[model samples]
Target: MSTAHDDLDNEHTILPSWERNAYAWTHSVRDGHIESRRMVTDGAIIDVILDGEPRFVLDLGCGEGWLVRALAARRVRALGVDAVSDLVAQARAAGGDFRLASYEDIIAGRLSLRADTVACNFALLGKDSVERLMPAVASLLEAGGRFVIQTVHPLVAGGDHPYSDGWRQENWTGFGAAFPSPAPWYFRTLASWVALFTRSGWHLCEMREPLHPGTGRPASVIFVLRRR
Candidate 1:
């Protein structure tokens, strides 16, 4: 059984785990080692973003700036923001416009950025941070703009755990040996996610499930939202 204290501790460990594995993660992303990303979720997110016809995009929690580069390739102006210094350095070295700011900083209005769309790709991994971050993100979007999020499908990611929202440990199975300590993430059920969006003053305009080719199950879920 897990206590609220344990949940808090796990949430706190998320950033440090990423800090330690930043290099390994960058390599994996650039080298395209993650099969699910290489085949499905990457394109799924890019497609969704492009479909929005966004002229300017903010890649929230953009790891290593791949999405920024990709969007830039399509002639869409983009800025990638991340809390990990090493990852931001790597992104800058790769010619991406990257900023180093944590979720807390963004929530506190540290970044004065506005965009037609804000994309968070597989990065909303916490409990409180995410809940608070959403409203702040809404302030960063232009009118008639959208907030897009891609995350592992709750049904698939839940595994054998109970179908409820809480903190869960990541094993980082396919990420190889370099990731010594995997981050623990807060899992939200579909209903919880919907409720969060409402509470954060957003309305879910669309929801998409991108499927895994082999398993024919959803690999991830994308939520497209508009300010309420």
Candidate 2:
């Protein structure tokens, strides 16, 4: 799911990105919109791998590969890939072995490289799109490898569904982000996400939704999956 950046969806997707569109790539992935990813990509993601002690990791939709660089610092064998050119150049310059390709291409068996673990932090993948990308992600891993993905919670991402109105009243929150016109996100519930993961051939081994520290409720859904 290419957020607002990808030109695929004309409708306002619940996946609101920082920039207006994927074509607008001058700013960083963190620069445009949605502060959620900053937290998701920073320590939370690294913790998943670091704690698990994954020997090899692949950063899906790696963007500029900041995460990959961080993974490298842990001495983990990590690789990253993205669909953008300049970002790929930047990632390489940063000493990350970043590739210029989409997960779809690699998943379709178009690429030769593979990894032991695949990580996707705050990447948006549509229902069908994830199906296509999953096998490729799984393929990169050795047997019993891990696949970790994070995205907008479905409850928050509900803004993506086709609506009769321009933007539905129920589709927004103060922090919610939309697609197309920058409406809000299409948030999925915990059940919705679990279903997607099981359908994608992953079995949920653990789940975490970090809170705002004082609210005592989940702030976001984080899942650690293992290939079944």
Separately for all candidates shown, the number of backbone clashes (residues 3 or more apart, or on different chains) is 0, 25
Candidate 2 residue lDDT tens string, 1-228: 334444245332423342343333324343534344454436677887787778878887777777888888878888887765666776787687878776568767766765667888765444445556765566677788778776655444444664221222222233333323343333345676677678778889887665544444444666888888
Maximum-lDDT candidate? 1
* Lowest summed lDDT window (length 10), candidate 1: 173-182
lDDT at residue 176 of model 1 (Cα atoms): 48
Q: Candidate 1 — which residues are off by over 4 angstroms?
A: none
Checking candidate 1 for backbone clashes, the offending pairs are none
- Tens-digit lDDT track of model 1 for 99-192: 9999999899989979999999999999888999989998789999999999989989999999998888887778644786778999999999
Ten contiguous residues with the weakest lDDT in model 2: 163-172
Give the Cα RMSD of candidate 1: 1.1
- Per-residue lDDT value at 68 in model 2: 87
Score every model by TM-score.
0.97, 0.71
